[model samples]
Target: MGLIDHLKARLGPARGKVSDLAQQHGDKVQHGLDKAAKAVDEKTKGKYSNRIHTGTDKAKGAMDRLAHKDEPGTEGGGGSGGGDMFTPPRTPPPTS
Candidate 1:
């Protein structure tokens, strides 16, 4: 197997453990994120309020996905379910 595949195989169990922990403590994790976001916003005097909120929301979404919150058998069920890592959206090339 390739290096990437071998690394993935080694880390699969760790990933599963992390997912289980995320599932169990998702609420707490989200709350902490909100708290941190609020602190940063306050520190910046709301200068980046919108961006801060957007980042916080993205973090929460990531946590939810990690917990498999949208998948069947978990709370808030009903999703095709994805266990893949986060893939950022690509940007279009700028016109000259």
Candidate 2:
């Protein structure tokens, strides 16, 4: 098997376990993220407040997806995948 395939196969079980743990401790994880963000912002004197909030939101979104919280027919389902992370932002056309 290819390296990527082998890695996926080996990590499959671990993924499920992590999903379960995420589901169980998601709130705690989110709380900790918020706390850390606050601490960082304080240390930086709010210089990176916007970036810190954005990063924290992205992290929480990832955790939710890892927990399958957006899967339909499941508890707490119906949330989106927080959009495509790889998609580039659209820019307005330049005026002539």
Candidate 3:
């Protein structure tokens, strides 16, 4: 098989496992993401608050897409493997 095909073959099961985990424990995963971001923000003394917020939001959006992959009306806008639901993106902080 070609390299891309070989990699996809190897990673296919992993993607399914991730989708299953995302399905089962998505909330906990998102919570952990938030907690980790908060810790990082605290350590940085809020200096990167904007970036941190943006990153956290992106992470959460990916998680949401993963958790809603198979549901109706979410195709082409979610994880290629699976998904749960949609969430509106948070507004980015205005830069000076």
Local accuracy by lDDT, each model: 0.78, 0.79, 0.79
Tens-digit lDDT track for model 3 on 8-96? 99999898788788899999999999999999999999999988997888788788776776667767654443322344556766799
Candidate 2 minimal-lDDT segment of 10 residues: 78-87
- Name the lDDT value of residue 66 in candidate 3: 69
Q: Model 1, which residues run further than 4 Å from truth? A: 73-96
In candidate 3, list every pair of residues with a backbone clash. Answer: 66-83, 67-83, 67-84, 68-83, 68-84, 69-82, 69-83
Candidate 1, residues 1-96: lDDT per residue as tens digits? 699999999998998888899989999999999999999999999998987986787788788778884356754543435432344764654689
Candidate order, lDDT descending: 2, 3, 1
The backbone clash count of each candidate, in order, is 0, 0, 7
Residues 1-96, model 2: lDDT tens digits: 599999999998888889999989999999999999999999999998987987898788788787774356544534554563443654655699
Better of 1 and 3 by TM-score: 1
Question: RMSD (Cα, Å) of candidate 3?
Answer: 5.4
